[model samples]
Target chain A: MKSASFHLNLLKDTERLSSSPVRLRVMLPVVALFACIGMGLWWAILFTQLLMVRAEAQDIDEDVKAKSKAHAEAISRQDRVREMRQQLEQLTYYRNGVRAIGKPLAKLAEIMPLKVQLTDLSFAPPPLDPPPKPGQKISPFAPMTNVETQRFVIAGRTTKETPVVALMESLDSAEFERLITREKRVKSFRQDATAEKGGRRLLAFEVEYTMPERRFAK
Target chain B: MDADYTTVARHFQVNAPWKSISGTEVPSAHGQTVVRPRSNGRPPTGKLPPRLTGLHSLAWKLLIDLMVKIQLTRSKTIEIGFGGKGKSASNSKVDMTGVELFSGESRGAPAVRLVHKKDGWHILAAGFVPPPNGDLPQRWEDTPHQPVWELPRNFQSPSAAIAVNSGMSSFSQASAEAILREMSQGLGDSRPKPHTAISPRLSLKPQAKAEEPQKPAPIGRKSTLPPPGTPVSENGRRFSMRPLAEEGFHLAASLPEFQALWLGRLLPEGRRPTAASIQLAESALMASPLLHPAFAETKGNMLAIFVRRDAIYFAGYRKGEPVLWRRCPGVKGYDAMRNAIGKALGVEEELINDVLEDALVDPRPALEPFLHPVLHQLDLARAYLAGKHSMDTGKALLMGLPYGASHWCHMAEESVKMKLVPGHPFDGITLAKGVDASLAHLHLVALGAAIAAAEVET
Candidate 1:
């Protein structure tokens, strides 16, 4: 006998209320509505965030465009400053290269034993650099290898080799060290056709001496 | 246990065959002819009938559909009414908890829980608890109190099938004789009745009885009673019935519409052990014998007498379908038998059990007075089933007597020529460990309510 045969349930189904406060019959639609609202809010927020990100990206792109020219100008000015500094450094090297030969030459006169009758006193420095070609861009900075070698020649009429040796020995003194070196060779020694005031038949001699190097540097 | 719900529903449909799509008359949900709108869209003729008030008729149809909805709640601990195919007598299925609420005497309701598992039915728990007070809502719009009764830890279930015994409850057929009796008893104090006559509610409310006799019943043939399975109100009484397994007959029940409304809302949910179904106490008692092993031995054909505290009832079953249910007229309950025994044997009322069981005191003097009427009524019922349905009432089963069942059986054999066998309420069910079987007699109606409510075929 199925119980349902005896089941004459007077209580209707609607009377089957919820045990918990949440009634599924009424709450299901309510929860669905709330879920729909929440999704809508989330979509709105996501769309707003996307718009904000797009706007920020555009602003950053425009800002970068606006600042690019100033950056380039600053870079050019910096390049000009660097060039001016390099030119000033080159000038300093030129100043440093200026040989203090005036004092040394003055001392050379004092050191020379009247050169036994001085004839020719000349410094044969290495030949000056070749000038720049026409239309060539010239750099103000000196070349890295700017040291020059010169030869100092002392040619005079002397009575004998002894006075010449004395003159060479006097040139070797410390006061003329920067101006002259020991590297020397006698070019000639011959009897002079012209005599001195006393008619002493003075021998003519020429001596060439290597001079110290002069360098262009920082 | 499987329910005969499909047969019952089909029977109801056949009895009220007004299911027509094109007509204005359609069958009501509860086996009655009612006027309703066309099925859908509009009639094929394209012209609206004058009687078809567009939205009103459509709304009525919607309302009827909504009210007739049947859904099986799965969340309930015992999936009540989860139908399956099988002989309901052998298919003692469902995990149900049955409780008789509002006991009407000290509110002492007995609770029984049955579960089908491991190839058999088990009595998970059977015990008595003090029933909580079930108060109806103060206003029609108010909701009843949830968690009205907090069952003990042992007796509790996720949901419960509730059986109630109310003074205002009545069960009668819609036959002419019964209607004539109803009309004759209108607005008057009548002889005692197992259902309405002796009810405390009726005796207390003479004014209600006076106020409700507005329409005199029809003399004959055109009975105003609602058709089977439909509820109808007349003379301040609400009546509903279901088609009987016996063809062309339906079993009817009545209650004060107020009491029906009250019982309907007695167990509002929102708490543990909410109600899964509700049934009349006598209705439950009538069905309690379905699961007994003896029922199967009898091939689902049997007759049984149910003895309650205040009333005695008879129920007959044919192949597990209830065919006969009646309250024995003029015969009172066991308490009256006790009163007769106390008066005839000059014994104290408390010692009535002793006198009846001892057999030392020949209390047949008092016993005969009580059993004579009951036995006569039983004989009439047995003869009726045999003559009408060709069902042999073969040695009717006696149940819920509490005591003196043997004496009653002996008397029945001698006087009525019918053998009476004592029935155990839990005979077909396996008792779980620690379950109290001693009080099984008290849980008859509760157990029946659970079984019947759970047996609806899905």
Candidate 2:
């Protein structure tokens, strides 16, 4: 019989892995120790930096806070100034509208014939006949639009139809064309017989024209 | 349904020793020791075997299942501690007689016991009650204080105490037999007894039988009465006789058989059958007389250098125990060595060294080149063993057939500077039989392994 022999693979297994568990046991503690040391060092650095940052922050705290307060006050003053400017602009827009009405009124006065007698002058939309319902849908081709387009209405009495025709020609002049379209200058014109004024037969009339719009400065 | 059993609970009222009493501090006496119980109160048990610990629970279960299927006894034991948390000796609720209860100082109130027997675990309640005096344990003081004992200057930690205790215990029980027993236990009982006697074999050769009859006993006793025809003494006690040359014949005769057995046994199980043959050629070297000096000089701290076709195996033996083994790769086999020689000799065909008496041709140049690389590796191997394992290369016996080739043995001897011996192929027994030297050298390692195995077996 042969003497007892050992398998090479078996021998390798016995010797090679014999110290593996021991190595792992030792390595774990070593790794943990290094990690703990690294963490401790990192914490120390962070804490020191925090202390230094806190000191510097304390020194600059009052300066920064005062500067911030002043900045806030300046911002508030700037907002108030902006509000005043906006109010002045709105007032200017209104004043410009009043001034614009004076020129148109002067022009209207120049255009009026002596035979014409004005009873009422107003800035309003022409009254709609049989006002549309709230939910009514206008035809796509309809001249009425969703936009609220204002118009000027004038109600007066004229002595003759000739003065009315002359007044319409004067209003359609180049100077008035800049303010209003001549084609739609008089939205509606009506003539009616009224009681005689100053021993002459009078023609009562109503006229509606495009309303003036005020354009503000950019 | 109304049950007769009713639970009764009572809380013990403890009396205070003092009402906020204060005492003056006093110096403690020197050399005074205090005995404190461990926090867990659980003694340390030895480590669990790696076979159990290395495997996962599922793997263990599978192994157990397989064993059960095969009807094999379970070789594993899993420890289960049954008790209340941190409760040791007092947890078990065994039957207590009246006398045992009265006499026992450690008797506590009755508690449930979970007993593990041959069948399974069983729940039990001890039939004992607490003493009627209402004497309960006092609360432990949690004040921080100095330790009870001072450590020796050398003692590093409390865990080292185990090693110290073991050292002390071993020191006290030290003896040759104890040392041997411990060595045997630690090394496993597989080591061979080198000096053990072999079973004598009956002489079978015709010349040996004639020579045995002719040779007289070295010592003789005179007898007055007519001598018995047989070589039996007058007291009728026969004497065992054998030629001195044949004393270790059985050992030499059994080497080959044992070598074959060891080769088979040492082969790794579950490996592919055709991977490689593990040649054990150390039998002749082991059985040679040259080994006796080395064994004596180092007390069996011998390193066997086994050269094979595939690799060079380095094994360290300390007192017949295989302490370490390392295999160095890239060793050139005999075929390669022979091819190199044939090429150097300008021979077109294979040259077989067949003559028994002719002078052996010198293939030194061809062999040296091949051997130089091997020697370099050997040197590195020695350095590794010395640096890592603390093995003294100078003290270890270096024996291998590779060293015997040409001037390689002398070269190794000079380098290692240890008790180096070129292993001869045969001992006295084989030599007396006049076995061919060529056949002996061819199977040298196998013969050495047999002898080594025989030594271990003996």
Q: Of the candidates shown, which would achieve the greatest TM-score relative to the real structure?
A: 1
Steric clashes per prediction: 8, 31
Give the lowest summed-lDDT range of ten residues in model 1 chain B: B38-47
Clashing pairs in 1: A1-B89, A2-B2, A2-B3, A3-B451, A3-B452, B1-B93, B83-B458, B229-B241
lDDT of 1: 0.66
lDDT of 2 by residue, B198-300 (tens): 1111212335335432432222232111110101111211111101111111111111122222222221222111101221122222322223345546554
Off by over 4 Å in 2: A1-37, A56-68, A88-110, A119-151, A178-198, A215-217, B1-458
- Position A203, candidate 2: lDDT: 73
lDDT of 2 by residue, A116-156 (tens): 87888876653564667899866433334323335666677
DockQ of 2: 0.01
Among incorrect, acceptable, medium and high, the docking class of model 1 is incorrect
- How far does residue B312 in candidate 2 sit from its true spot (Å)? 25
- The DockQ values of the predictions, listed in order, are 0.16, 0.01
Task: For each candidate, give the TM-score of chain B.
Answer: 0.68, 0.32
